[model samples]
Target: MYILLILAAITAINLGKAFGTEKSITGKSEYALAVDVRVSVPSSAFSCMKKYGYKTVFVRGYDPTGDGKFDSNAVDNIHNANKAGLGTEVFMTPQPRSDKKGSQQLVELYEGLKNGDIKVKTIWVQVTSPVNWFPDTKINIDFLNDILSAAAHYEVKIGLYTNGYDWSQITNNAAADKIMLW
Candidate 1:
């Protein structure tokens, strides 16, 4: 845990360092940025990802249906992101899922990415739907706990994506060091 914090801090510092050591937006030398991608986002879109100078990225690993497996475009995104010299992290949309089911999905995503040799800087689980309001606190909290546990077992840095209120309610004050907001 302490190591993860140290690494995160180092990464954060490195991220900000990319913009040069001048007084800037965050008023801190250490800042970080992340970009989101899905299977539908073609590798061509990343041709200029390096220009944005993001230090981290969130790439989708699963699609919502049918086989419910690894996304076809994930590898291309990972490859392109790597080519752009950005650290990549994988995420899965976890809305409308139970704790048990969400945990399984998390594990499945990890395994699928590993099988494809697509290692990443971290794993992020999505807890919000951009289109709809997810109102079930119990389900959200449960799912978060399960995913957190699975993430620990996998020994990888883990984080979440949600709007404001949903984060506090869904995580129930879970001790995650990183939380991305909508």
Candidate 2:
């Protein structure tokens, strides 16, 4: 039981580091926990999450398939989260196989968020799931570059959501050192 407790503590520390919830010199977390959701949640849900110690929420901002449009609930979700006293951010899962270019995808999301009066500080781009990426590494790199270029035009920060293996398979770890990782 003591060993299990030790392992749990180690896991928690690693997760804290990954989420930027660094531990202070006094051994207490300097930041509160965060949560991510892809669906529209009630305002009461966000209040409960805050009550449980969550400080932030990341909402899905785009839908890549079918209509390839912004998520209908993203604005409402962000407002609800903010109303419940949680910091809100947005994330997009790019569709590399679609006919649309990366820049076009990002523009659609950015404009939608802007029209809804949702100010996004950082847009986390999910680059996992090899099946969602192009088979050619160069194509994947170009696609990611397009997204980066468009993000620059909008002046929003971009974060990558990927593991080493998935990243290697998708873009051969291109620009891994530059962009923030989630």
Candidate 3:
């Protein structure tokens, strides 16, 4: 029992140190941007961010192939952003999912971005439907927590964007560090 207690203490200390070292957005290297890709040309939209000299560029979720889901083209966008020398991020519009599903979606997104050599700096949830309230039933406090946790694991900032209190449900407070309201 004493050995187990010592191990637990060491683990706790390590975990605390790790969380303490998590990144914060309090420096000039960090920047804010706007990406309304849902209604704008991606290349042109990203270029606008560069022209404006924003270190970070937010992107609306892309289903470039019209497959009804994000695909390799999403990766291509990340590569394009990297080539432009700007950090990329995504504004996720959940289409109904659980925390596990949301995490998997991010994994897929990260895979595409990493494989395409695109460096993603953050991902912000975009819950913009006031009619349905929750556009995707999968989007919830648990889902937000899962996404933010995943973003931290990947070293990508997590954020959310909405006109009002769309994301008022999530309690992790990561969106404070990760979001840019529009």
- Candidate 1 has a TM-score of 0.66
What is the TM-score (0 to 1) of candidate 2? 0.82
Give TM-scores for every candidate, taking all chains together and pairing residue i with residue i.
0.66, 0.82, 0.53
Can you write out model 3's per-residue Cα lDDT over 1-182, one digit (the tens) per residue? 01001001111122212345658623333224433344333565456657976454445453422222454345655556656777656756654333235566666677666676666787666655544334443445555566667777898876555544444433322235424443
Q: Rate the local accuracy (lDDT) of all candidates.
A: 0.61, 0.79, 0.51
Q: Measured by C-alpha RMSD in angstroms, how accurate is candidate 1?
A: 8.7
Residue-level lDDT tens digits of model 1 in 24-131: 646445556556777444444554555655576567886656535657767777877777777777777764443236667777788887877876547766665533
Off by over 4 Å in 1: 1-34, 40-44, 52-55, 65-68, 98-100, 130-134, 168-182
Task: List, residue by residue over 56-102, the lDDT tens digit for candidate 2.
Answer: 78788888776367888788889999999998879897788888889
Which candidate model has the greater TM-score, 1 or 2?
A: 2
Q: Candidate 2 vs candidate 3: which has greater lDDT?
A: 2
The model with the greater lDDT, 1 or 2, is: 2
- Candidate 2 Cα misplacement greater than 4 A, ranges: 1-31
